[model samples]
Target chain A: MGRLLERLDKVDRRVIYILMAASVIVPLALKLDFPIPIGSGPSMDLYMAIDTLPPGSTVIISFDYDPSTKAELQPMAVALTRHLFGHGVRVIGMAMWPQGASLGQQAMAQAADSLGAEQYEDWVNLGYTVGAGVSLLRMGSSIEAVYPQDRDGVPYDSIPLMRDVRRLGDVDLAISLSAGDPGIHSWVMMAKDTYGVPVGGGCTAVSAPEFYTYLGTGQLVGLLGGLRGAADYETILRERIPGAPGGLATPGMAAQSISHLVIMGFIVIGNVAFIAGRSKRKGGAK
Target chain B: MTMEIVGIWLGALLTLALYSFLYRDNPFYKFTEHLFVGMSAGYWVIYNIYNVLIPNLWDRLVGTGDAAPDMMMIIPAVLGLFMLARLVPKGAGLSRISLAMIVGTGAGLSLVTTFRTNCLSQVEGTIIALTGAGTGQFLSNLILVVGVVCGLVYFFFSKPHRGVIGGAANTGITVLMVAFGASFGYTVMARISLLIGQVQFLLFEWLPTIPIFRGLTG
Candidate 1:
C-alpha cells in the first residue's frame, strides 16, 4: 500500500493533462449549464454606468487586446457593444494595440448588423495609432489631431460619427477592454485623470486584482474581470434587452465553472499526497 | 470545398499542430510555431508600412491634401530612418540617437505620472476612513489598512527582522503569501478559461461540419 501510494505521487504528468483536457471538453460537449452567482459589485456598477447613459450619448470603447486574448475579452466587447447599440447609444471605437483594431471592427460590425445600426453614423473605427498612452494624451485635446483619418484613410471630418463628438470630454463614457499594459492603466491615467472622463472596462482575470485598487479609488467606475465577468455582463444585458443573442461568454462560463471544480479536486488530491509523503518521512526519521 | 469549410479545416489542423507540443515537441509543432511567428512579423511590417509610415510619417512629410509640407516633420523622419540603421551592423551606432530620444521622452513623461498615480493615489486609497457606520464596512476597511501596512513592511529590508519587529514582519509575510496565493489561483482560472475556449472551438465550432456531431449541435 505504501509502494502504491508512492507511485501515485509520481503518476505521469500526461495523465494529468489528459484529465484536464477531458474536464474542459466533456462539460462543453455535454452542454452543461452551471448556475453562476453574479456579485452585484463591479459587474453591477459597470452595467448601471452604461444603463444610465441618456439616449444619444456617445461612448468610446478602446480595444486594447488582440486575437491571443480574444476568447477571454471578445465576448465582453461584443456584449458591451450590443448593450450600447441596443439602447440607442452611439459608439466611437478605437484601438491602442495595432492588432486590436481589426478585432474591434469585427465586433462593431456584428453588433451593428444585428441591430441594423448604421455604419459611420452610429459607430466608426478610428483604427490604431502608434503611441501607446501618448496617443491617449493627444486624444484628450483633439482626436482628429491624433488620428487624421479613419481606418480607410478617409479624413476624420468626412466621417459623420465625429459630427457631434470632438474630443474625449464630449463623450459620456470611455471603456478600454484590455489584456495588458498600455490598456486600462493608460486609459485611467490619460482619459480619467487628465481629461476627467469616466473610465471603465474589462481585463483578464490575472489583471483584475491590480485594477481593484482603481475601482476602490473610483478612478475606474467598474470592470469585468474575465470570462466570468463577461458572463455576468451578458446575463444582465440579456435580461434587460429581451431577445438578445446569447453570446459566447454564457456557455464559456459553464465550461469555466466545471473546469475550476476539476482543478480544485486535483489540488486537493495533490496536497493529500504531499502530506502523506511528509508524514511517512517524519516517521522514518523517528 | 467551400471557402468556409476549408478555412475551418485549416484552423483545426493548425490547432492540432500547436497542441502536439503537449505530447512531445515534434516537427509539426515546430512548423506551426515558425509559421505563426513569421506570419505575425510579416503582418506587422505590412500593416505599419501602410497604416503608420504612409499616413503619419509620409503624409505629414509630403503634406497630403490642402496642407503645406511641414519641414519640422523631416527631423523625426530622419531619426526614424536612423532607427532602421540597426539592421546594418556598421550603422548600428547611429541607432543610438533614435533610441536615446525614445528613452528620454518616455522616461520624462512617465516619471511624474507614475509617481502621482501609482504612489500617491495608492497611498490615498490605503488611508480609508475608519469611521464608516456599518460593522461590515469597518472590518473590511480595517483588513485593507492592515494588509497595506504589512505588505509594505514585508518589503522593508532596511530594519533587522528580530524580536517585536520580527513578529510584525512574519505577519506581513503571511499577508503577502495569502495575497500571492490568491493571485496564483486567479491566474489558474485565467489559464483554464483559455483552455475551455479552445476546447469549445474544437467541439462546437469545428466539429459541427462532420455528420456525427451535426445532430448534437442542432
Candidate 2:
C-alpha cells in the first residue's frame, strides 16, 4: 500500500494526460448525455430577451471570437442564429475579431441553410470591422460609416435588410459572442451605455464571472456563459421548438462533467499524498 | 479522394502531429508548430492588406465608383506610416509621435466611459438596500456590500492593517481567494471544452471519413 501510494504520487505526467484524453473520448464515443437544467440565471434571461422580441425585429449578433475559442462560442452563435430565424427576426451578423468574420459566416450559413433562411434578405454578414472600441463608438452614430459594404462587397444600402438599420439605436438588441477584449466590454460601453440599445453576450466560461457585474448593473440584458450556457440555450430551444435540432455544446456537457470529476478526484488524491508524505518525513526526523 | 476528404485527413494528421508532444517532443511536433505559426502570420498579412488597407485606406484615398476621393485620409495614412518608423534605428523617434497620438486618443476616449461605467455605476450598484430585501436578496446584498468593503480595505495601503482593519483585510483575502478559485475552475472547464471539441471532431467528423473507423462513430 505504501509503495503504491508513493508510485501514484510520483506518477508520470503522460499518465495524467492519457487519463484526461480517455475521460473526454470515452463519454463522447458512448454518446453519453446528462440532463441540462435551465435555472433563472443569465442563460434563461438571455433566452427570454430574444423570445420576447416580435417578428421582424432587428437584432445584431456580433461574433467577437475566432477559431481559438470556436469550441465554446460557435455553438452559441449558431444556436442564437437559429433562435432568431425561428422567430422571424431579421438578423445582422458582424464580427469584431478578424478571423471571426469567416467563423460567423460559417455558423450563420449552417443555421440559415437548415431553416431555409435567405441571406441579404433575412440576414446579412457585415464581416469584420477594424477599429475595436472606436469602431463601436462610430457604429453608435452610423453603422454605414464603419461598414460601408457587407462582407461580399455589396453596398450597405443595396441590401434590403440593412436599408432601415442605420445605427446601433435602430436595432432592438445586440448580442456579442466574445472570447476576449474588443468584445463584451466594447458592446456594453458603446451599444448599451452610449446608444441605449439592449445588449447581451455569450462568452467563454473563464469570462463569465467578470460579466456578472454587468448583468447586476443591468447593462447587459442577458448572458450565455461558456459551454454550459450554450447547453442551457439548447435545452430551452429543444423544449420550445419541439423538433429543434441537437447542438454541439449539449453533447459536450457529459464530457465536461466527467472530466471535472476526474480533475477533482486527482486534486484530492494529490493533496492527501502531500499531507501523508509530509507527516512521514516529520516522523522520521523525530 | 475528394477535396473535402483530403482537407479532413490533412487537419486530422496535423492535429495528431501536434498532440505527439504529449509523449515526447519530436520532428513532427516541431514541423506542425512551425507550420501553424507560418500559416497564421501569412494569413494575417494578406488579411490586413485586403481587409484593412485596400478598403479603408485605398478606397477612401482613390474614389471607389460611388464615393468621391477624400484627401483628408492622407493624415491618418501618414500617421500609420509613422508607426512603421520604429523598425529603422534613426527613424525610431518618429514612431513616438504615432504612439503619443494613439495613447492620447485612447486615454481621451476611455477616461469618461471607464469612469462612468466601471467606477460610478459600479459604486451605485453596490449601494443596495439590505433592510427591505427578502432572505435570499438580503443575504446576497449583504455579501455584496461586505465583499466590496472588505476588498477595498485590503487595498487601503495608507493605514497599517491592525485590529478591525486586519480582520477585514483577512476576510478580503478569503473572498479574493474564492473569486480566484472560481476563475481557475472556469479556466479548467474552458480548456477541457477545447479538448472535447478536438476529440469530438476526431471521432465524429474525421473518423467517419475513414472506411474502417466509420462503424465506430454514430
Candidate 3:
C-alpha cells in the first residue's frame, strides 16, 4: 500500500485535469441531447402558472444573478419571461445584483421582440434597486417611496406604466432567478409571505434543496434548479414556442452527462486501485 | 464545424486550466482565473453604468434635454452618488449618508416584513395535515419548520447553556451542520460536473474537427 501510494502520488495532476476537461467539452460540441428522466411536476407547475395568468395581469421578475451564473441562469430567465409575456401579462422587472440589470434588460427586450410585446405598454424595467431585499419588502405597499421615478428617473406618477400600479397587492405573481443571498429567500420572505403574492423561482443546483422544503410547503409554487433546471425550463419553452432554438440547454445537458460519466469512471478506477494495493501490501508484509 | 470545433477546444482548455489549481497553485489556473475575472468585471461595469445608472440614475437626473426635465429625480440621484464617497478617505464620512439611507430603510423594511413573512407565515406554513391527501406535504412542512427553528437557534452566538435548552441548542447545531455539509457536497458535485462538461466538449467535439487535435481523434 505504501509503494502504491508512492507511485500514484507521482502521477501528474495535469493529466487528470486534461482528461476531465475533455470529458466536459466533447459532448457539448457534438450537440448531444440526453434528457435525464426529469419529473415534470416542477416544470409543469411553472408552465401552468404563467399559462393561467389573466391577460395583462401585473407580474414582477427580479434578476438576481451576475455574469458568473449567466451561462446557466440567463436562458431560464429568457424562457420564463417569454412564457409570461406570451400570456399577455404586463411585466415589471428589477435587479438586486448591480450587474443584473443589464442582463435583465437584454433578456426582456429579446423576449419582448420575439413575442411582439411592447415595452412600457406591456412591460417596464425599474432597473437595479440599491437596497436589495429591503427595497422589495418596503416597495410592496408603496412603490413610489422606493422608486420615485421610472428606470430613466422620470417621475413615477408621470410614467404610463406606473400610473395605476401601487403596492404588492397589485402584482399578480412574483418570480426570481436567484444565485444566493438577497435573492429567493428574500422574495419568499418579503413578497409572498409578507405581501400575500404567489412566488416561483429558479436557482443554481447547489442552492435548490434548501428551497425544496419551501416547495414541499408551497412557499414557492415551483422551482427550477441549476443548469438542469434551466434546461428543463427551456424544454418547456420549446414545446410552447414550436421551432424556437433551445439555446444552451441542449449542449449544456450533453456536456453535463459526459462529465458525470467521466467522474464515475475515475471513482471506479480509484476504488480498484485501492483494493489492489491493499492485497499487494498484505502479500509484501507476509 | 470549424467554428463550433474551435469553441469546444477553447472551452475545454479553459476547464483544464481552471482545474489545475486543485493540484496546486500554478500559472495555468492563474491565467484562466484572471481572464474570467477581468472579463466578468468589464462586463459588470459597462452594464451597471449603461443599463442601470444611465437609464435608472444619470439620464434621469441630468437629462440631455432630448428628454424633458424630471424635477423629482434630484433626490435619489444625490443619495446614490453619496455611495461613491465611501472610496475617499476624508470624504468617507459622506458615505455614511448613503449607508444610513440604505441600511436604515433596509432595516425598517426587513423588521416589518421579516416578522410577518419569515416568522409568522412560516409558522403557519408549519401546520401539517398528517392524513390522506396532504400527508407528504404535511410531513415535509413539519420537517421544514423544525429545521428552520433549530437552524436559527444554532446560529445564536450568545451564552452557552447546561440545561434542557442547552441540549436543544446543541441538537440545533447538529442539524445546521448536517445541512451545511449537504450544501457543501452539492457544491462540489456541481463544480466537478461543470469541469467534466468542459473536457467532453474538448475531446469529442473539438478534437474530431480541429487541425491541432484532429490527429488525436484520428
Candidate 4:
C-alpha cells in the first residue's frame, strides 16, 4: 500500500496529460450535452442591455482577441452579433488586436450569413488599428479620425451605418470581446470613465475576476466571462429569440464539465497520496 | 482538393505535431513551434505595414488624391524613426526622446484615468450604505465591506500584525486565498475550455472529412 501510494505520488506527468485529453475527447465524441442555466449575472445583464435596445440603435462590438484566444472569445463575437442583428441594431465591428480583424470578419460573416444581415448598411468592419489604449482614447473624440476608412477601404462617410457614428460617445453601448490588455480595461478607462459611454465586455475566464471590480463600480454595464459566460448568453438567446440557433459554447460546456471533474479527481488523488506518504515517513522516523 | 480541405488538413497536422510535445520534445514539435513563431512574426510585420504605417504615416505625409502633403505629419514620422534608432550603437541615445514622450504621455493619461476609474470609483462602490437593502444584498454588501477592509489590512505593512490586527490580517489572508483559489479555478476552466475547443475541432471538423471517421463525429 505504501509503495503504491509512493508510485501514485510520483505518477508520470504524461499520464495526467492523457487523462486530461481523454476527459475532453470522450464527452465530445459521445455528443454529450448539459442544460445551461441562465443566471442573473453579467451574461444576462449583457443580453438584457442589447435586448432592450430599440430598433436602429447603434452598438460597437470590438473584437479585441487573436486566434490564440479564438476558442474562448469567438463564440462571444458571434453571439453578440446575432443578438444585435436580431434587434435590428446597427452593428459596428472593430478590433484592437491586429489578428482580431480577420477573426471578427469570420464571426460577423457567420452570424450575418445566417441572419441575412447586409454589410456596410447594417454593419461595417472598421478592421484593426494600432495603439491600444491610446487609440481607444482617440476614438472617444473622433472614430472617423482614427479609422478614416473601413476595412474594405471604403470611406467612413460613405458607409451608411457609420454616417452618424462619429465617436465612441455617439453609440448606445460599446461591447469589447477582449483577450488581454487594451481590452476590457481600456474600454472601461477610456470609453466608459473618460467618455461616459456605457461599456460592456466579454473576456476569457482567467481575466474575469480582474474586471468584477468594474462591474461593482458600474463602469462596465455587463460582462461575459469564458465559455460558461458564452453558454449563459446562448441560453438566454435560446429562450428569448425565436429559432435562435444553438451556439458553439453550449455544446463545449459538457466537455468542460467533465474535464473539470477529472481535474478535481486528480487533485483529490494527489492530496491523499501526499498525506499518506507524509504519515508513512513520520512513522518510520519515530 | 478544395482550399478549405487543404487548410483543415494542414491545421490538423500542425495540431498533432504540436501535441506531440505532450509525450516528449521531438523534431515535429520543434518544427511546428518554429513555424508558428516565424509565421506570426511575418504576419504581424505585414499587418502593421499595411494597417498602420502606410495609411497613418506614409499616406498622410505624401498625400493621397486631392489632399496636399501634410508636412505636419513629419513630426510623428521623425519620432518613429527616432524610436528605431535604438538598433544602432551611436543612435541609441536618440531613442530616449521618443521613449520619454511615450512614457510621459502614457503616465499622464493613465494617472488621471486610473485614479478616477480604479481608485475613486472602487472606493465609492465599497462605501455603499449597508442598510436599505434586501437580505441577500445586505449580506453581500457587508461581505464586500469587510473583505475590502481586511484585505487592505493585510497589505498594510507599516504596522506589525498582532492581537486584533493579527486576527483581521488572518481573515484577510483567508479572503485572499479564497479569491486566489477562485481565480485559479477559473484559470483551470479556461485551459480546459481551450482543450475542449481543440478536441471539438479534431472530432467534428477534422474527423468528418475522413470517410472512415465521419461516423465517429456523429
TM-score of chain A of each: 0.97, 0.98, 0.91, 0.98
How high is the lDDT of residue A122 in model 2? 95
Query: Model 4 over residues B74-181: C-alpha lDDT tens digits?
Result: 999999999999999999999999999999999988899988988999999999999998999999999999999999899998888998898889999999999999
Runs in model 2 lying further than 4 Å from the true structure: none
Tens digit of lDDT per residue, candidate 3, span A1-286?
5666556645576776677767665665565678655456776687778888889788888899876677667877888888887778888888888767778888899989988988778888887776667777678778876766656656667667667788877888888989887799998887887778899998877888778767766789888877777778777767667776665554577767666677677666677677777777899999
In model 2 chain A, the worst 10-residue window by lDDT is A1-10
Kindly indicate the candidate among 1 and 4 with the higher TM-score.
4
- Chain B alone, model 2: TM-score? 0.95
Cα lDDT tens digits for candidate 3, B60-143: 667655666676888877777777777888887887887888789777767876687555655676665545657676676566
Q: What is the C-alpha lDDT of each candidate?
A: 0.87, 0.91, 0.74, 0.90
lDDT of 1 by residue, A114-136 (tens): 89899899999999888887888
Against the true structure, candidate 4 reaches a TM-score of 0.98
True contacts kept of each: 0.54, 0.61, 0.38, 0.79
User: Candidate 4, B107: how far from true, in Å?
Assistant: 1.2
After superposition, candidate 3 runs with Cα above 4 Å error: A1-11, A142-163, A238-247, A264-286, B1-102, B134-182, B189-218
- Top TM-score model: 4
For model 1 the local lDDT of residue A230 reads: 91
Model 3 interface RMSD, one decimal:
3.8
Would you estimate the TM-scores of all the predictions?
0.97, 0.98, 0.72, 0.98
Q: Name the weakest run of 10 consecutive residues (lDDT summed) in model 1 chain A.
A: A31-40
